[model samples]
Target: MIAYDNDNIAKVEQAYMLKTECLFKLKKKEEATKNNLLLAKYYLDFAEGIFQNDIQGALRCVNYYQKGIKLYRDNGEPQKAEIAHKRLVEIQKEIPQIMVPFSIELDIKGVVDNIKINMEGLTFEEGLIRLTQMFVFEKQEDIKNRVIGEFKDHPLAHMFGKRCT
Candidate 1:
């Protein structure tokens, strides 16, 4: 099949047509043949989703990946099956970061710094945006050894000679 540019609809359509033709060619073959067709289709869909920058579509690709992995395993292609499973797992790890809500708790000096914000049901990207909009750091200080941090004492401190009020 032709690896056409995804940016061009006509080319993409042609590619799909070619893929369909390939699928037709694989019809009435052994179980391995059907599995191979499924694998190819999944790969094509996954690549297209990534190229289009469609997060939902990309997530859908995970399902296809899982399907392909199972088919590969059933077809006795253990190595390819294992690789496909790994790829699906890797994709799953990133998916929660994008689609799932998460909470980050930071502790400073044994004190739980209260953000006092509700980030529930917000994706990672949305949470970052909300945090940036709501919180503004006017200034920051580094307290090292209970004294005003200096360049000699704290190489990490950016402000010099600034003490805590």
Candidate 2:
């Protein structure tokens, strides 16, 4: 039996994890698996207590929880481990998907003239807005003329026209 010392929970938890890892590494140790399994559960429980209300800590706890579940399953304690597995899955599913931006640069030479034109630093929304103003707003002839005169031979002009249509 291990003595409970609330003030030394962190140190105790680290000791448990180290002991569990050592037991797991031993090849011919009798009942070492069971001891490691129990130690994993104790470490996870301690980690959970320290992780309350902190997202990064919660992520760390998920690792400990996963380790505990693996140990529990190896020791034939499936029922208890199943709950941890389910919780881990729930937490994983709750993580938000992150979107990354992709950018491309195109260079064009003017039609009926030889002026170099570059359209960069424009977002998808900004490109859409410029296209809309070109096709939908007849009063914006100055902007339309500039675009057509500059990018008449550019590949993106056809795409912009298709989007407008």
Candidate 3:
């Protein structure tokens, strides 16, 4: 439990797997199911933490989420399974990169709300174009490029490394 809260993922996983196996063998179905439920949840957090930086992290995240849905259903928690499914669906809608490669989306609404960018209800590409115009008008060329090129497939990626007009 300490290892789990401290993010020592591998150790927590090993302990849970072993404990659950022993519990199942001893005919402790309820205990085994509860352990699996907890482990599946741990996987959700672990995968979400790593997905942004590593490609394999995304794959593992989705895989573990699917596994979680199964675990939840097996434990007679259909609502939990549905919740995981809805979360996965929402992520896929916001970031299709989960299902396909080479395209990523920056959540403009979040930027509008958190960073106060005021580009609400706009597409990312439109936002990028507006950003380029703003930075160009303000003569902040370096910042423009860095912000525009934040993602590999950024809408203005081709304009990067070039002086903005």
Candidate 4:
């Protein structure tokens, strides 16, 4: 049971987490559960503080929000858990899109938009990657190298097992 004060969010979070763990070990189930809830909310506050400075922190927020929701539910606070659960879903929805550069996203979308085949068994990413592969492999070596060079510093191609290099 650490009281939140002017201390930085991280310190407050650590204190609550340690207290929650200590309480559980002392056979203080009720106190542990309450502190667990506090620690969960602190996770949210910490993540939101990061998010305010950088929207890219949504990736980090996903983990914190998921932990918060679980802690809330396990502590008999399902109503509180639901709020965090919705935020988790929204963060998950935004993750795949957030890291991709605008130009790269447009390139992939251009391929996806003009596709002639039915990508019935594929995710949108799988289908786009298939097209990128076909386009890359069909080129003469010089052109192939040049096109891949464009994405050399970008991660989406490499992340999907297609090395742009």
| Predicted structure with the largest lDDT when compared to the true one | 4
Off by over 4 Å in 4: 1-10, 52-55, 95-156, 159-165
User: Clashes in model 4: which pairs?
Assistant: none
Residue 59 of model 4, lDDT score: 66
Model 4, 4-30: lDDT tens digits are 552465677678878878898999999
Local accuracy of candidate 3 as per-residue lDDT tens digits, 1-165: 626444777678788889999999999999898888887787777767766645566666777778778878887789988988998776555444543434445555644464345466678998777666654355588768776667555764553344322
Model 1's alpha-carbon lDDT is 0.57
How well does candidate 2 score on lDDT at residue 14? Answer: 68
Off by over 4 Å in 3: 1-8, 97-165
Q: Report how far residue 7 has shifted in candidate 4, in Å.
A: 7.1
lDDT at 20, model 2: 61
Measured over all alpha carbons after superposition, the RMSD of each candidate to the real structure, in angstroms, is 19.2, 15.3, 15.6, 12.1
TM-score of each: 0.37, 0.43, 0.50, 0.53
Q: Pick the candidate with the highest TM-score.
A: 4
After superposing all C-alphas onto the true structure, candidate 3 shows an RMSD in angstroms of: 15.6
lDDT of 2 by residue, 4-79 (tens): 6644656765665566667668763546766766666775675567555556656666777887888788777889
Cα RMSD (Å) between model 2 and the true structure? 15.3
Q: Which structure is stronger by lDDT: 1 or 3? A: 3
